[model samples]
Target: MTFLKPVLKSILLTLLIAFTASLNAQTHSKNGMVVSSDKSSSAVGAAILKKGGNAIDAAIATAFSLAVTHPSAGNIGGGGFIVFMNSEGKTTTIDFREKAPLSATNDMYLDQEGKLIDGINHFSAKAIGVPGTVAGLFLAHEKYGKLPWKDLLQPAIDQAKNGFAFNWSLYNAANYFTKEGNTNPFMDSYFRNESGGVTQPDEIWKQTELAETLIRIRDKGRDGFYKGKTAKMIASFMKKNDGIITKKDLAKYEAIERQPIKGSYKGYDIYSMPPPSSGGVALVEMMNLMELADLKTMEFNSSEHLHLVAEAMRRAFADRAEHLGDPDFNLNIPLDKLTSKEFAKKRFQGIDMTRASVSDSTKYGRLYDGENTTHLSTMDKDGNAVSLTYTLEYSFGSQMGSKELGFIFNNEMGDFNPQPGITKSNGQIGTAPNLVEPEKRMLSSMTPTIVGKNGKPYLVIGSPGGRTIINTVFQTVLNVLEFEMPVNKAIEALKIHHQWLPDQIVYEKYLLSPDTKKSLEAKGHTLKERNNMGALMGITYDPEKKIFTGASDSSQPDSGAVGY
Candidate 1:
């Protein structure tokens, strides 16, 4: 009886742990109207919807809250894109990609010997670009927002001022800040005290300066940051750090609305942002090429399926490096022709089904660009959907914070080609079409997409993984639309990515078995294991039931989904 009792106790403990893990991995919102990578932000957005706010308003509120709650990626210091779809099926794209400062020169990161300088393109003040998040969010609110702009900003301001529970991510953020060459005054002030002591994870992380900054923006509008003391402070920081951003650059920064790049897949319409975002064309072209294969007939995640998808990814990225760029800088982007079905068919025809293909630096047709970014999806009762993707370029965004403005800055200049078409001494080829020029928007791979049936949005998806953004979204959509998986399963499934340059297929380490690797390697693929790749967040709608189902990538511990 004693032995039996011990066995029973062991079974109970194991079952209890498994149940708890399942709960920790996901959240279900009875309402399903809002979802984000952070729980607090999701709650903020959901509350806005409950208060009669529309999708845009909810997204704005969520964005502001994230600046306080999810500081790693949610930011006011960087720039990104917005793809919005109204209930009537009308869609619009906002291009808020950061632009090089007027003083930026093409060879800013190149040495006198015409060689690329180490860390020059990503670190220090020189790498900074003009930010657009504030202007972009303001413009979005002014146009489609139902709630007052100040109302959207208030929650974030309160969160910053009052402080929230210090989380594991916030702990990691502090660790990163304390590392040598990773110091910043703005970040230090939050993590370290005026007495030069660091705070513990259990202590509060209040950002009084940031709260004040948000208050100014709330009261004075966009000009609060662009024209006032905030702008002067940013300029002074740049001058101190050897960065080139000037007050004039901040004053001139504006968020431009561009036409959404449209594509169709298996009878469903796909809408995403256009250049200088490489995501839209790449996603559209990849889907078109995917149509060439009968993916539905193949087993999901099988070597056969993965092989075909990886080939499509490689080809699309090759095209990205060759033909996609900022329209204002490169006038002949051929977006329409590139995303056309016929073009996809031609590209698809070039693939050898049984083996992998080789790719190199000289591969891009003429063109294109990657970044660390964040994403969220929102859907109100009205069926209006918004997929928002924003970034600070790197974690902690240049690892340097502004003491005065209380926000980090982006190392966005790294996205531009340092040299034109030539492989430098460092064995790197420059992307000419995406090269830096005065007022030129650098290339980006931030793809925020909406998938619909008969002009009504059924899915909203996006992710943050530098160049892996395209592949993550592609696989997530494929999982749901092709395999008919539920929204949560779609995000849970293992993802694989292949960019043409590396000629290697990187898969989540936990996803592939020895057999899977051997089978893929037999087909000539260079397989590599990675801890993880993408942070995909999604929301789906079931029209027949008129119900919304939202989810965030289970891999993100803090991800949240909340409805009514």
Candidate 2:
């Protein structure tokens, strides 16, 4: 009987283990209705949904949490754009782009010899622009949120205070942070202990200062961060670090509401971020050009399909390099001309079915200039969706941190061209399309998009990658809309990009078919292989069940989605 009892106990233990594994598998299943770049961030959004808050509320909550838990790529110290579609069928564009500091000029990154010094660190105080995250979140909540503002922010505050466990992705990024060329000295302290060893997984890391900052904003509203002590602290840090940001800059910064750029493809309307971000215009232009061909019938990953897409990207990129900039700054952009059907038709004429075009021979019209930026996107149940993009230019921005503020600044100044006669002082630059100017927002490739079917919104998606962002979003959309693949498969599909100037088509090894790659090479398209391209997050509606299905890029380790 004693031997039998011991066997029974062993059986029970095995059963318990099996049960736990099953539960975990279900929780982490890819079929969840809501997806995000961070699981915790997705949980925050799920909480908002469970609280009866709409998708907009969930998005705001998730965004706030990302700022705290995923600061490496998500942040409160940066700016971005949001494209939202309401239940009433109205779509709006919220532009919270980072404004250039009053002291910024077109040549800030130029050395005395006029050579561009890699002095622009996205992580420094000098690189910090007027932060728009707080204002942007508040604006979305005020207009579309059902939950209390405090409720939306509380999750982030709690996460920051109680601390979050370090994960492999964070650890890997921290290791990347330690690389020599990566500036931002403050990261050394934040990411490591006194021994200079990376923080292990499950180690608790608290951002007390950031927590306090969130609390003040939660209690006193946006004024707490923009006009009060936080603002003062930011200004002081900027001043101490050779940054031009001032209290006036913070106080004067306002989030603008702009018109969204809209385009149609395969009977669906696509709403995306507009200028200052070249995402919407370029995406629209690229899609429009592709619509001229029979892409749906072409086999997925076939040489012909890849060739057409790559050629379309080349033409669109040529247009981008030739005439795209912050509209308020550059008068020569010819936005209407660039987006015109006539121009698209003319550009499409250059596609040779079997070969890529020569850059100089493409004739993409004329060139204009100027600046830098990043992006994010969100959606909620009630059919409300938002796509936002922002940036501090280079990674770690400015290489200058505010010793007191405990945060780094943006080095967006380098978005400017140092070559004289190329860029103007008022944010208008001819050679480098993303130059810096007093109070002007820099240009960006962050494209947050929402696609509609049967006159209703069906997909909410966006990604984070500099020049490749546009192509990533475009290809993903085609994968879903044209290829008729599921959301996850669509996201997992191989990505290919060609920016025209590089004269090379970059392909992810996972997506390249040996046959297709060989064929592309045979046709004279120079191919450059890379490991990954961008981080894409999206939620698509399952019309039959009326439930949303979310998908996050596998390229990023920490991003995923959650739902009630």
Candidate 3:
């Protein structure tokens, strides 16, 4: 009897732990909800919602807050895309991706010898693009926001001026960047203390300069960033630092409203950003291919299931490299054919069920995107939804910015092909479609998406994984829409990525069992393990129950879901 009692206690403890984990994974709210990579940012969004702001208002507020709280990816010096769906289910998209400076040339990243210059493309002031984040946010607000722009911008300003608690993550990141050998002058000056040391955990870290910049944006709107003191400071910094961006570039930047790419999968409608973002084209194409199989009957994450998904991913990425690019620059992109069911069927027919297809770089473009970015999801009681993803193109971007402005410059120019017509086995592509050009927007894989069912928003989802973003969003959508998993489980589920050029599968650490890996290898697929893939912020709505289920990826220590 005593031995049996111990086993029973063990079983009970395990169940309790599972229950607790599930509870932490997701939150339910009857009204509006906001989920983001940082708790403070999420709380800011939720507070806006509580103050009668719609989803757009909340999204704008959350983005600004992230610029203050999560500076690694969120930024005014960077750019991103947004997918918005009104309560009526009508959808639109905004493309605010950074543009190459007017002085940028096709061979700018190459030396006189026509060879790529190591580190010059990404580590210098030349990498800073004309930022569009401010224009993008202000445009969305002008069209759909329910709250005053001043109100939405105030929270971030307050956080930057009055200071916010520096947590362990912020402290560690600052310390790492300020270390003796790795020190960045701008990083050390702004992110550290008056004593010339890293900001300690729990200390109040303030950025009076960033606050002043935000105030300009609040008062003057878009001109606050592009035409005023902020613009002059940015232009002067670039000029003195041997960079080419000028006041003219800043004044000329504008955010465009593009038609959302629409695709249907198993009766649900998926809407996502169009090019210059490859995210939508690749995601819809993958979904189209997955629809060819009855994924519902396959065991989740089993070798067969992952194989099919990977095969689809490979084909989609190949297509992405070959056909997609900045729409304004490459006007011939066959977006219609690429995302069509017929096109998917044609690609699906080539998948070998028993073996992985060979990825020939000769036929595909290289994946040159960086992995550091941030995403957020917001939903209001009015049924308006917004999925936003933004980035600085690398962790802390170029590690360069104006000390006076207190913002990091985006390394987005690195996303363009550094060398033309030079595809490498190491995954460097010199494809023409993404070559740098004056005032051209670079290609990206930032996938911000909204899924609709029965003319209402069923899900708002996005992630920040650079080249891996399309696959991450595809997998999350599959987990919920196809496998019928709960919102939290869908987010926490292990993810895999295949970029087609590398011809290898990158799976989350421990995502596949030994047998599954062996089985995949037997099918001639090469596999590599990564710590994790993405930090997703997602929201799922139950129309029948009128409940919004919000989820923030647990992998990010500060991620949170807040609602009111």
lDDT of each: 0.83, 0.72, 0.90
Off by over 4 Å in 3: 1-24, 365-368
Residue 194 lDDT in model 3? 60
509-545 in candidate 3: lDDT tens per residue?
7456779999999999999999889988999999899
TM-score for each of the candidates: 0.93, 0.87, 0.95
Candidate 1: worst 10 consecutive residues by lDDT? 362-371
Best-fitting candidate, scored by TM-score: 3
Q: Let me know the TM-score candidate 1 reaches against the reference structure.
A: 0.93
lDDT of 1 at 409: 80
lDDT tens readout by residue for model 2, 1-564: 988997997788668545533322212222224456678888887877777887677777777787776765566777778888886668988887787888877777668886655545343455567777778878877877788999988999999888889888777767876767865567766677435677777788677777888888889877978988989888877777667789999998888788888888879998988788788888988888887887758888899988889888887877776667777788677667666667777778767987666655234433211123333445555666666655555555554555455444555544444344543322223455556678887767788898988767788788877778899899988888877877667767789988766678999864587889999999889898987777777777766677767667766667676766
lDDT of 1 by residue, 157-252 (tens): 998888877778777777777667854556656576435666567677677888999999999989988888888888888888788989999999
Weakest 10 consecutive residues of candidate 2 by summed lDDT:
23-32
Per-residue error for 429 in candidate 3, Å, reads 1.5
**Local error of candidate 1 at 513, Å?**
1.8
